[model samples]
Target: MGGLKVLCIAIVLINGQTIGTVAADGPFPDEARRMRSANEFLSPALRAEQADPIRNRGMLWVEQGERLFAQPPPPGGAQSCASCHASPETSMRGVAARLPAVDAESGQLVNLEGRINDCRILRQSLPPLDYETDELLALTAYLTALSIGEPLTVSIDGPASAFYAYGQQLWSERQGQLNVACTQCHDQSVGRKLRGDTISSAVPTGYPAYRLEWQTLGSLHRRLRSCQLGVRAQLFELGSREYLALELYLKSRARRHLIDAPALRR
Candidate 1:
């Protein structure tokens, strides 16, 4: 079984601190409580799309991803992902909910896109795909789409704890000339409109998300990079440890939130 396969079925704990369920975070203050769930703050139009994935434009990427998953790999490759896994519905359902799993071979944490790249290089005998490319997004969206409606139950205990802590630090620490941390906008200003968009919880439930600005489905790292650029900070490499760490942290915060990949965002 794959690394994510085991975690998805076996470990089912909420990855981070939950509001009211446990002692809420003190550093976050009462304002943070307002940002409990991404579902809470959305316009009627956008929220309608969130509830109906079938109508969402991002589903176009998922259809592309489905075709890509079954097609044979480029010349000289062993086989396509579908050749080994059979149906994505049976094998990949809920897989994304457990992602950014710990890589047993390297002991380094890897996100869904990074894991897909690693598999292509090692298993498919192909070069790593470029980050944020359409192919990668398609594949990621297809798999993550299977897990839609399932809660994010990524483990943050034991081997994953260190990465979680580092991710937590990064989430709290301010960056850039503006001196704003993710906590400032997401945590402090949950409902407030920042440049016309309501501030979300920074939770990672919706990813491989379709942003009106991008006009396409994009990876979570892409969104994070936007946040960095917004704050005037140096952008990390797409699949860098920093992005992965931040991803883990964000997923943790969205503990019980259902997977909403390829979601539309304004």
Candidate 2:
């Protein structure tokens, strides 16, 4: 288990307040409340005990991801993820649980898909895929499968310490023209309606989720950026340091949430 010493210290200094369950607000606040009222975060034991049907579906995605990694696009310049990821079980071991990680060089926290696209751009020299694209989903499904029973872990050590602290500050700080913080909606009024849709608790265990509204699957970072944009807050570039730092902070909050990919959301 990776200890979040820096994260804890930073959180204490930044928040200086009690941590409570996400609040309820919005049009369908009741529905949101119903969704998370008795929510039990996904634990290692529960992950191990999950029924075969669910695990099988996850496995199917993993297998498809593996195939996608092998299939080259057009004039094959470089191979797919298998060229490096190698064994899905071994290469991706414990990866999903450690994601939304802080990158040492760039000093940013990056989600699983962000890291993958980074690899694709740097190692493979291929253009990064759009968020929640089929390629990204397959890869996420495959990597997440490797840590089905492992505990989620994100580090806030060394260079990441400062970034994590920055993220924590961002999490608590109230801003935007609406003068509302993410906590106000996500944590404070967790079960509520923004417009016509229900406000979920905003857990991040799942990524590259299939959304009915978008009619496509996408990464958590994309959603986060969208949220920021929605609030008319400052929008960071994809894979930017500030964005990544915020990602790490958010993942820490969803320590034990279940990974629900291919999820249907409005």
Candidate 3:
């Protein structure tokens, strides 16, 4: 696949049982078929680790996020996130799965991370949180965890149509020194081996995830940036419109796939 020898990896459930082997060299599955989460491509050990909170390092960020959510607004501000939206368990449930949407008030596209900063700047009257910072990652992790099993339902209708179209275009356009596009690996070569790692369907269900390579929780944009670097493409800023549009497209493609934020990945 993609000029590399295909390699099959066991698809294991969290209970440590091998379900099957993904066909590494097979053609892309039909769109009518149900989309698979990237978690299904993980090694058994990593799958088990992701299912166990004690062993999953990503949970630490979720815990920190819970604290930040409950914190009072900085002096002079009137509301904390928790103040506007009560307990996350009740209010934030399923919110992450529908994100990267057009914010009703601002009329701008906002993902989970963008929403958090929006609240900080507009509501709390504070500076926007830096991208990839611990605080931002933590809050994103916590909120995403609330919708762990919710299916993605990001809308591309109305004003969001343009962004979604741009994202789809970016997905297929070739770039970088390798002259590769995202579709080459994530679509055409999915389930194949790349440097000992299985190529997944490029699902975004695992944002704010803890990657073994990074050894810390990171956002989807962070992962996107890494992929650009791997391809030697021009890298966009963390919150750049290009990345945001791409994110919207990914989530839209992943419609109905259950979310697994703070996910564990190799």
Q: How many clashes show up per model?
A: 0, 13, 0
In candidate 1, what residue range of length 10 has the lowest lDDT sum? 11-20
Instruction: For model 1, name the residue pairs that clash.
Output: none
TM-score of 2: 0.67
For every model shown, what is its TM-score relative to the native structure? 0.85, 0.67, 0.86
Question: What is the per-residue lDDT of model 2 for residues 1-266, given as tens digits with 9 covering 90 to 100?
Answer: 48834322110011111111332232332323333411233334433422233432334455567567655643544656777766656667778878776666875567787888898888787888775567677888767655554444666677667877888788778776767787787777865666775576666554554444565656667777778878888777766767677877766655544344433344
Tell me the tens digit of each residue's lDDT in model 1 across 153-195.
Answer: 7888889999999999999999998899998888788778877
Give me the displacement of residue 174 in model 3, in angstroms. Answer: 0.6
Candidate order by TM-score, highest to lowest? Answer: 3, 1, 2
Could you say which candidate leads in TM-score?
3
Which stretches in model 1 have alpha-carbon errors above 4 Å?
A: 1-35, 52-54
Model 3, position 49, has a per-residue lDDT of 83
Best by lDDT: 3
Of candidates 2 and 1, the better by TM-score:
1
User: TM-score of predicted model 1?
Assistant: 0.85
Colliding residue pairs in candidate 3: none
Off by over 4 Å in 3: 1-34
> What is the Cα root-mean-square deviation between model 2 and the actual structure?
13.3
Candidate 1: global Cα-lDDT?
0.76
